[model samples]
Target: MSGDPVAGVTAKTFGQLPDGREVELYLLVNANGLEMTVMSYGGTIVSLKVPDAQGNAEDVVLGFDSLEDYLSPAYRSANPYFGAIIGRYGNRIAGGQFEIDGTAYQVPTNDGENSLHGGDRGFDQRLWQVSAVDAKDGVGVVLSLVSEDGDQGYPGQLETQVRYTLTNDNALDIRYQATTNETTPINLTQHSYFNLEGEGGVEGQSGILDHILTLNAEAFTPVDEGLIPTGEIRSVEGTAFDFREPTPVGSRIDGDDQQLQRGKGYDHNFVLADNASDAKNGSDAEGLVLAARVEAPQSGRIMEVYTTEPGVQFYSGNFLDGSLVGKAGQPYEHRSGLALETQHFPDSPNQPDFPSTLLSAGETYKSHTRYEFSTR
Candidate 1:
C-alpha cells in the first residue's frame, strides 16, 4: 500500500459511487515521499500525510476513507466545503438569479430560495476526468472538468483544469485555470479546511477562535442569515473582523452585530489588498501575501494561507456538531474546525461594488491559492 513515496505514485479505487460508477483516487507522493490522496469525487484531497516539527507525519485535512463515507448519512464524511473544487460561480446568488448584459438567468435555489455553492449540484458533487498523472511534475494527477454553458444555472461553457501538485517542501499547491467560450462570470476555488492535527469532524479539537490570524485587509463584506452579502464592505477596525495582526478569533466573535448572527458565527468575506490585480498580471508586487496564519499551539503546527484572490472567507465552523467521526476516530463538533477560504467576495455577481468575478471570451481565468505548513 506504500506505493513508491518518492516517485510516481499510483492510482486505485477505494470504492464505487452509489450510481455504480467508478471513482478514481490518485496518491501524489512528493519528492520527499510524503503522501497526499486526491479523489475524483469533488476533486477532494482525501488525505495529506506530511511531517510536522516533530518529524511525525499525519493526515492534516478532514475526510473519510470510502466513497460511501461521502454518500452515506451515517458518518457525515461529507464536507459542504472540504477540499472540493467549487464552481463556475462559487458562492451564493441571492434569490437564485443574477443579471448579465441586461438579461437575467434563473438559477436553482437549493439554500432557502437562494443559490448556494452553485446549487445542490455544484462542482463538489461531480466526478471529473483525470487529465495528467505525471509523477514527473510531482502532480500525481490533474483533474479536468468541462461545465456546459447552462450547467448548474450558470452561463458559458467553461473548460476548467485544476492541478494539484505536492512539493517536497510539504506544500500542496493548487492552481486553477479556466477559459470560457462566451461572456460569463467565473469564480473558481478549492474549499479545503485545515485542522493541522490530521483529524476530521469538529470534536476532540479545541477552539480555533483563540488561534492567531493575520489578514491583509481593512474591510470586509457583512452578510445576512443566508450568508449572502448585504452589498456593503465594512471596515474591520474595532470589530472582530480585523486580522491585520495575529489576533484571537473569540475576542469579538460574540459581538451582537447583525452580520455575526447572519453567519451564525464568523462567516464573513475579507476584502484582500487591491494588489490582487497586480499579482494576477504577474508583476513583482506581493500578490500572494500572508492572508492568514493559524497556529495549533498544543500540536506545534503552524499554517499560513497565501493567494492572489481578492478576499478570504474566515469561517469558524460555527455549525459543526460532534455527530461526525473523523479518520483519526474523533467526532467533529462546533468551532473545533476552522476554514480560511480565499476567493473573491461572496455574492459578487450581484454586488456592483465588489471586485468582478467575471470572465470573457479569450481571457483565461487563473487563480492560485497556497497553503504553506511549518513548525512553531
Candidate 2:
C-alpha cells in the first residue's frame, strides 16, 4: 500500500443540494502517490495529480474549487464543460429530434436547434450515488445513476455506472456500463479539459495551444455553422484537421478554414482508425485503440488516450473567455485547456453511415477509456 496521506479511497462531505442531499468527494491515490479527486455531483473529476519529467506532481485537470462554484448561476452557461461526465448523448443531435424504432422523439434543445450533451440538465449536473471498490489492480470508486423513461425525452429507464480506477502504473481508467428497459440511444463520455502544464496553466500561466497532439485518425466528421455534423466523413489529408502526426495544436488553429470558423477552434470528432489494424498485428485488447496522444513540451508531461469508442472529440476550450475563475484563483481563458472526449460519433442516430449508439432492453452498453499519464 502507498504511504501517502490520501491513499486508497477516502470520502468527505463536499456540499449539499437545495433538496438537502449531500454531495461527497472521493479521493483515490496509488502507490506512486498519484491522486485523483472525484465528486458525487455529476461524477465530476475535481482534480487529477500527475507528475512531470522531474517527478514534480501537479493537478492536470481543470475544475472548480468548491461545489458552490460548480452550482453557480453561470456554471452551465459560461463555463466550458470541465471534468464532468457528459451523457445520454455526448454530442449534438440534429434538430433535437430522432426516430427510434419508428417513433420520433424530441429532446430539449440547448445548443441552437440541436440537442447538446443530453439537454439543459444533463447527467453532468446530476447527483450520483458513489461507492468505493477494491479492484484487482487498484482501488477506485463507482458512480451510478438512473434516468427515467421520459427524463430527457429519451424512451427508456436507463441505469448507468461509471467506474474510475487509478492504477499504480499511472493510468486513470474510466469504464462505463448502461442498461435500459426500453429502446434508446446512449452515448456517455468524460469531459475533462486537460492541460498537461497542470493547474497553473489553467490559472492563465500558459496556453495549451503549444501542446503537441497526435490522433490516430485519418478522417473526421465535418460540421455546419451550428456545429452539427454534416453527415460526411471527410478526409483530413491536406487539411488542418490532420493529426496523424504529432503537431502543435496552434499550428493551424487560426487558419481561414470554414470548419474552424464554425467551431471557433478544434471542436470536431476524429474517427479513430479501425481496430482491425491492431488486430492484424495481434495487439488488439478489448478493441481499445489509441485515440489521441498529447504532450506538454515544457513540462515533459504526456497523456495518451486509449478507448473502445469510435471517435474522439477534440475541443480546444474555445468558449472559455476569462470570465470564470478556476480552482487556482485565475480566470480560465480561451485555449486554456483541451478536451478529448472519446465516444460514438456525433448524430449517429441521424447518420445511417455512422456507427449505431442504440441500446436495447436485452442488451448491455459498455465502453471504456483509459488516460495513461507519463513523462516523456
Candidate 3:
C-alpha cells in the first residue's frame, strides 16, 4: 500500500457482492511504482497497474466493475480463472470420468461437455478467506480456504493456502500449498492475462509479434478438439509449436494444422525443460522451472515464469471473438488474450504416463510460480 496518494485511491474493506457475500480486497504497491488490487473473492486480482516507458501506469488485466460484471457470463465469471487461484484440478477431464486405484469416478462437466478447471463449482468462483497480510514484506497477502468432502466430485476435505507477494523488484510471487485427508488429485495455478501494451493487447499493443518467446522444451502434448491433451508429446522442431527462436506468434498461425483448428489457435501444453543437470535442484525444483518467457519489444516488459510443475499451457485466446468489450471499450478479439498456465499436464489424473498430480494423505502438495517482470 503506497501512501503517496492518488485521488479516489484508498484502502479499506469494500464489502458484500450481489450474493450478499463479504469479500476483502488487498491493494499492493511494488517498489517500482507498480500497484495491484487483490480480493478474497475467488482470491482474484481485481486490477494490476504497471507503468510504461513514459512512467504512466495502466491496468493490464481484464476484470469487471460492480458484481454484475462478475455475475454476467460475458465477464467470463463462470471460468473463475480471471486472475483467480485455480486448484484441486486445473484442467479438463474426459467426459468428467477418470480412474484411480482401479475405481472410476465421474465428475460433472462445466465447460461445454468437459470438466474444466475444478468443475462447475471450482475454487475460482468461491470466496476465499483473507488469512494474513504482511506489509513489512512488501505487501504479501495470504489467502486460505477449505474444500468440503465431495466438493466438485473430488474426494477429501482439502485445505489450501495461497500467498501472493508484490515484491520490491517489480515482480509478483505466487505460492500454492495444500493438503488432503484422502487420496485425491490436485493441481493449482494462477490465470492472469497480461497485455504489456495495456488496454487492448494488439494493434497499439506494446508488445510486437516479434516478441521473443523461448520455451525450454523439445516437445508438447497434442490436444483434441475439446482442448484436452491427447497424451502425445510431439516434437516442436518443425511445427508452429516451436519457439526455439524468437519467432513472431503469427508467423506459423496460418499454417494448416488440425490442433490449431481444434483450438482455433495455440492452446496446447508444452513439456517443461528438464533441469536434471542440477540433481540437487531436481527434487525441490519439482515444479516447472524457467518454463517460458514472453517479452514485449516496445515496453521492454519481460515475463519470465518459474514453476515446479511439468508443463506450461500457452493459450492464444482463440475463443475470444471480439464479442466482449474490454477495458476502454476495446473489443477483446481473437488472440487478444493469452493465458500462460503452469501446472501438471492436463488430465494428469486420467493419464497414467503423465506426472502424478495425486496427493495422498500425509503428502504435502506445494508449488511455487513466479511471474517476474523487468525491462530488457
Best by lDDT: 2
TM-score of 1: 0.91
lDDT of 1 by residue, 157-205 (tens): 9898988877657667777888888777777777776776556423443
Better of 2 and 3 by lDDT: 2
My TM-score estimates for the predictions, one after another, are 0.91, 0.95, 0.90
- Candidate 3, residue 284: lDDT: 45
> Can you give the lDDT of residue 371 in candidate 2?
96
Q: Which stretches of candidate 2 lie over 4 Å from their true place?
A: 1-3, 202-206, 275-285
Local distance difference test, per candidate? Answer: 0.75, 0.88, 0.73
lDDT of 3 by residue, 57-105 (tens): 7777766544455656766643436677786688787788787788777
| lDDT for each residue of candidate 2 in 1-376, tens digit (9 for 90 to 100) | 2345656999999999888899999999887789999999999999998989998888888898799889888876774667989988999999999998789999999998999999888899899999999977877999999999998898999999999999989899999988899888898999999999986583334579999999999999999998889889899999999999999999999999999999998999998987322221011247777889999998999999999888899999899888888888767888889999998888988987788788888777888899999997
* lDDT of residue 22 for candidate 2: 98
- Deviating ranges (above 4 Å) for candidate 1: 1-4, 74-79, 133-137, 200-207, 274-286
Clashes of 3: 8
lDDT, model 3:
0.73
